[model samples]
Target: MGFKKHLSSLKSYEAGKPIELVIRDYGIRQKDIIKLASNENPLGTSKKVIKAIKKEAKNSYRYPDDSMFELKKSLAKKYKVDSKNIIIGQGSDQIIELLVQATCGSEDKILTSSLTFAMYEIYASHNQAKVLKTKDGVHNADQFIEIYQKSKPNLVFLCIPNNPLGDCLDRSEVYRILDSISSDTIVALDCAYGEFAAYKDKNKEIKPKEIIKKYKNCIYLGTFSKLYGLGGLRIGYGIADSNFIEMLSKLRAPFNITNLSLKAAIIALEDSTFLKNSLKNNFKEMKVYEDFAKSKNIDFIESYTNFITFMLPKSIDSSSLCEYLLKQGVIIRDLKSYGINAIRITIGLREQNKTTIKLIDKYLKR
Candidate 1:
């Protein structure tokens, strides 16, 4: 059996360690484990969304509405865009794959931040396209503009409030980079954590309606996983001009979303009370992490998202620290794979935060 030569160089995305696996590895009780590795909503799922999912469970035997009528309508109203401007995917990830498939071929290039989402590079490789990154660890408009002019990549991905790093560029800065690119180059603004950023600082908000209305080459990607407590549901959407949406829609498979996911996402959109309380708790707990970092003289990024990335000192290895915590049944993301000596932890519940902090303090003292 022959596989593409490039497939050998590709690596699978290493997700956050699951609790069952942790239990098997460390012999820890399930209730004792604290998982802050994935940037999932600490508040858990909304009651309204749960009710909708329960109601829709009976209909799971039937195929989903491929048109995605209800979910799109809800998203459209929220973003103030037309239903024609939207396309649904399993997650923003599938949409990313669709964009690469629709626009790229061998030797074509995709430009993005040096230390952003891993999927951007993985998907580009699937199409045998080259991936270019900024010299900086995070997104720099100046660096992006320079690279865009030099590489003229077929697609550019901007991960706002970037994952594993937690830094963001303002709308004006993002637009400056966009302004420099030619109309033919497609740009993807991935704001999966946008709701958290917007709640913290208005300037960080990347409005989908404003983006779609302004640039035909641009598309806005959002997900229900981060803030809506729907990572398990795998429902996400993309917003672009009607023409672009139509083009991507052509590549999407029918019934890509499940019945329960579609129903949950629609109700999740309307569950503003859950969203508000989650945001409040996120920032409140985020401060605890910040204070802990400062007390320990550990440097960390000021996060707009629900998680914070702590840049470990030269004395502390990221993998070593993560392993120590994992053995104790506490899980968090280690950025060693991203070539950084850092750990990205989701802002968990108050008790979870305190437990993790005390454990970190113990690690440092040891």
Candidate 2:
């Protein structure tokens, strides 16, 4: 077995467990399992997008438009960017892998926050790039610049309103970090939660084209998985200068996105009604988790994203709390793998959110 020595140690990215798996494992009825683990749109995929997907499914025999011309044009219009600046991927996961494959030599390094997305490290490991990560839970641009200066990594990643923890830093802070870092380094900002982030009073807006044009080395990543309720479709993209996009395009697989996913993404993008409602629900329901945490004296990191990660009281073990919720047929994410003893729950529908909190409280009382 002459597999690359580094590949053996790389762990696959663990996704939030789906409801079907949870139901089967725990012998719970399907409807009874309230899955608040993944930061998915609890309102569900748009009817318009579903219709588009079904309509396009008949054309699956033919390969996807290899150029993905129309979809890119739609995204370009949506972001006010030129089509050449956009590169769609099967998911943001592929874009990250493509970045690592394109830039990292065996001896180069990839850097990110210690507990941000894991795919950055997983992909870098394949190239045998030394993955350097800062220990801060939140993104502090100055701190990242300090680490980057010492390490001089070839690729850098920042997950906005970062995964699991949901902490965020605004564009001004991002600009500071970009200015301090070596201009030659490729900085990838994973804005997977940007839509949820767009409406905030502060730290809400980022001009990706402007950022890329000024920095020249930045790739801004976006996804339809969260707000668009298209996780099952597997569509995501990156925006950067045309030159950078052209370089990365060489490494991307042909027909990287499926036909149905592409069509649905276009429909989802055009459906302003669905997008508005998803954002509205996320902003309103997220506060309930915050208020409930305070009332229960449960410690939590403040979040701008659709999920809230809160810690159980010291008297209660994290696993026990999770298990209690599991028995009650409520599924959520545990952050032990992220090295934090907390639970991250998506802002589900009002009833689901109510049930999750009530059962958690009942478990505490027991």
Each model's lDDT comes to 0.93, 0.87
Give the local distance difference test score of model 1: 0.93
lDDT of 2 by residue, 1-366 (tens): 998787777888778777788677888999888988878899899999898888888999999998999999999998888999999998898999999999897889988898888888888888888888887877878779888999899999988879878888887888888888777899998989887776764565667878778978999999999888998889999999999999999998898889999999999999999889988988788888899889988988877788988966668777778778887788888877877778889999999999998988887788
* Tens-digit per-residue lDDT, 155-201, candidate 1: 99999989879999998999999899999999999999999889999
Please name the candidate that would achieve the greatest TM-score relative to the true structure. Answer: 1
Q: TM-scores of all models? A: 0.99, 0.97
| Model 1 ranges with Cα > 4 A deviation | none
- Alpha carbon deviation, residue 234, candidate 2 (Å): 0.3
